[model samples]
Target: MSQQAALLHRSTHAIPKTAVGGQGCYIFLEDGQKFLDSTGGAAVCCLGHGNKNVQQAMIAQINQLSYCHTAFFGTQASEDLARFLVDSTGGKMTKVFVISSGSEAIEAALKLSRQYFLELPTPQPQRTRFIGRTPSFHGVTLGALAAGGHILRREAFRPLLTKKTSHVSACFAYRGKKDGESDADYVARLAAELDAEFQLVGPDTVCAFIAEPVVGAALGCVPAVPGYFRAMKAVCERYGALFILDEVMSGMGRCGTLHAWEQEDVVPDIQTIGKGLGGGYAPIAAVLINERVVKVLDAGTGVFRHGQTYQGHPVSCAAALAVQKTIRDENLLENVRRMGEYLEAQLRAKLASHPHVGDIRGKGLFWGIEFVKDKSTKEPFDAKLGIASLIQDTALKPEYSISLYAGTGTVEGVRGDHVILAPPYIVTQEEIDIIVNTTVRVVTDVFNSIH
Candidate 1:
């Protein structure tokens, strides 16, 4: 019997190759094959695998203290990580709630947003609803899942998800914007739609408006157009609803900014960050609260009614702090911007004119290529063909030895397909060339096979 027989994998029919080790930009399988990690394992390994700094930090923390329940004791690791995150925001975000994953961070943000309203001097107990955007992915946990609009991920749990959440059209320009609509007009239209949704749901009854700064997974790496987030935040402000930004896949230097919102000209009332936080060295994520929300809670409850056994794991915090410091010390964000431009140019120069490639968009080291059945019409391929998955599988073959992140339901809830290429912050021009070249070959081969 296979050693993996007892383990339940994502797919039961096929056992995935065991990843025995990784370093820098490549992962080595048990069979000794090395594959370039273009997608950062869902865009998490910002510093890439096996960083000595992060590993040593985790080891040091473990030796000092590995487990300290937040309720009983506080560790220096957690406090330092929190301070570093708040300082990184330039004190715009006053407090940080360290957690174990992006899902937990989001769940905490949702609960905190609701609690903030209740703790307000006016005390809006009516604010029980949350408004999110369609084709957006927050997380998989119940609260986070309900707060998102990833139809396929939410399908099985539709009956269990909260009915209080409603969705508006995503700020996806490729398929969302009208042919002749100006950027200002497109922003206005989306803002108006959000306002209408708030009104329909009773603006006063909404707790917050949640969305990713850049749409990940469900819609691939789709960033909002200029002035898009500012307009949405304005609507949320008008309705007295907190604005929540989930930067799990786009922030922490993924988009050439430590915080993705910095580029959007807006600040979130509450923000959830993960993925690159620990650089895959350990599990860590955080919920950042602005002064407005922090002040309210301080004046009223003085306690956030949430707890997790691993709420502020010392080893995780240490790992994340080291990752952040590495990014700062090495000035990787600058590299991300420079290499990101090179990547975008290479991808467009090579694949933009392909018959099946429809749109290429993203920021920093993150990018997505949408495949279409009819380029002129922007029609998506049939869902059953699984173009994104096919491209991923093709890219991972021995000849290619590259990994790409795939996504479906780019058009509405279930049609369009896209694949994301989010390389590590340490990625170079040479690495970018390899990634793009492999992507071109894999995409070309996949489409040709189907044809």
Candidate 2:
């Protein structure tokens, strides 16, 4: 970042280039730099940067009824959007608690799950503990921060978080898979670890097992192995616990399906989703609840205990409705699948042979390329080297001026490095080739300097 950018109000020392305009798969910087939006603004913007239908929907909603507090009344936009999501989800998910941001939606889900237990005929007062993975991200808010497992993010706020949650092993194959372990064996090991955590916590005391179906920031788009969710779900059910999938980064057609778990062949009792839900046209997220939990709340309290000022904001719902509709109507998910395969193939063909490249893995339009110092032994570059950070910084100079996502501490708490690519769903094969070609050049350039 330049001195002027550093002086601005953004929190991080690394200032982001301003996005001026976008159409289709391109994002134009304030200085008129056009780059393929691979990360979808941190896995947001599913319909791409500037979708015409979503924008028109937002405009229409504003003209009709922009903002209406739900305390007094509800709008047709909110009601229709709710029905749309519920129906699309196959009607098994009975309720949607909308909020302004992903973190807010997570907060609401946590509170709602806790309150649902309280409303039960046999109240589970002991169900105060939340079980989460070791290297996962839920959100950035204090409560959501507590539920997350990013040590660097949680370091400062450890004292502020409630001592109500416990950490477990994440189902990451690259780092967590044991020596010579089969996929089933690895999943069994992870499930055992979770079962042991339940035993340690006294199963009855736990509330939900929270995890990202495909991890986003912490592990750089790491998807759990097959049968991983099923095994984990069994453990949760054995303990009479709830399974909560944080699809905030993977759901809503980002992975070429409506839900990431659909590919996993399991269902979450409570699911949290955002980013792509409203396509960045308006800030929106949702906590999707199954019928079992809703029945408890319906029979006992008859009203939810939580509230948000912007819950179910009509304009946000309208924008999301249009975004979802366009995806279905235009068959954009097909494009996501086709382009995603091309992106993966190109990444593999280009960087699979690179010396510093350790692993490249992802699905659909979401992908990650991990880097290391020694490929034979998979030893990471020293953190002081800041390989990932350097790559992030170097890509933004006057020469390249491209935007990419970088991550660190991929192995343990403070080792390993990788970069993520989550292009928009509407990306074309031609544009994907450009993204792949530029990425190869960028990685080659960054590693050349470091080595």
Candidate 3:
């Protein structure tokens, strides 16, 4: 084995293999093994890998102007990308702040939400608390972490996390809905729960209600029931609090639409997007400000009292602009819809009846297969079993030659296991078949061995 490097990774017990190269949806390791990248490295690589156009765009920007402080100058790359994003939303979102990663974007969103209250005409100094959905995964930064509801992730850092953020039950129909309860009833119940929380916390004391339009890793691709988002948004509006949607994993065409909230029939006061923004070519994320929020800042302070050195980075913006242009010019959103339908059909047909396969959910190119110990009761295995982690490891073996994103704590923040598959937008029918067949084989083998 090679000597351990000086870098600190997520785990100190294990070091991952070195990825030497990648093309399309497959990554090549240094040892010459190839593996299909199903989850896009946590749903980030929308354009797959090695796209010449995005590369050239980034390289050209680096040649012309690589780095510049956002305070000093505004590059064409940032301005053009921001304009494209605004146009994409039909001016619903009037301003954009490009940052390096999803975590940073989320941090900016939280801070901006707080700042928005402070800059209001009346100045709501008491609006300091935030409300988010349970089992949500927003980001890792302190403010973002406080707003997130992943118990396992927040457990160790609980002492340092602010108590200002509170969580309501997520719109998880699989386990949350009762057998006799209708969708409308369940949504009303959840909405009432949110309202009661606001009342308990003092409605006027809340700054915003934040949630992912479609829940991601923490809950394993669970989209809300019909009218769920609208109800939540109404609650926020009733309380005069902002509605913030964290689309870090489900945005940028990953959910068939450019924005997942498009399907929900609701507009957010603030939105954070990453993962698919730069398609993993460069580290980038963004916060899109609604015109209402922009208006308050425009009228009051006339300046957002926040600054980051790498905000609106030129090269990252160039790469992201090219990525967005490719999605539009190539009409990839249409492909996402088509492939999403095909992928859903294949998954249900192949694994829906499997005993361990409790649920299959997601939209567009992003999907998740949740595992259970008992399908009849929907009982999750114990956390110590590490089923999700095992699937991830076994899928990367030489024989399998597949890579999947795995998650635990799907049922709240402690139990349940799931594996997510988020293939690239350019994937084809043949590749889809391979992905499904390999997934079936891998899951079957893993369980077969255990039995």
Report clashes for each candidate as comma-separated counts: 0, 2, 0
Residue 78 C-alpha lDDT in model 1:
92
Error at 375, model 2, angstroms: 1.4
Candidate 2 Cα errors over 4 Å, as ranges: 1-8, 11-16
Report the alpha-carbon TM-score of model 3 versus the true structure.
0.99
Clashes counted in candidate 1 amount to 0
Candidate 3 lDDT over 1-451, as tens digits, reads 4557677867888788889999998899988899898888899889899999999999999999999998888999999999999999989999998999888988888889999999988899999999988899999988888899999999999999999999999999999999999999999999999999999999999999999988898988999999999999999999999999999999999999999989999989999999999999999999999999999999998888889999999999999999999999999999999999999999999999999999999999989899999999999998898999999889999899887789999876899999999999988888899999999999999989888
Q: What is the lDDT of residue 241 in candidate 1?
A: 89
> What lDDT is reached at residue 404 by model 3?
77
RMSD of 1: 0.9
- Candidate models: Cα lDDT each: 0.93, 0.85, 0.93
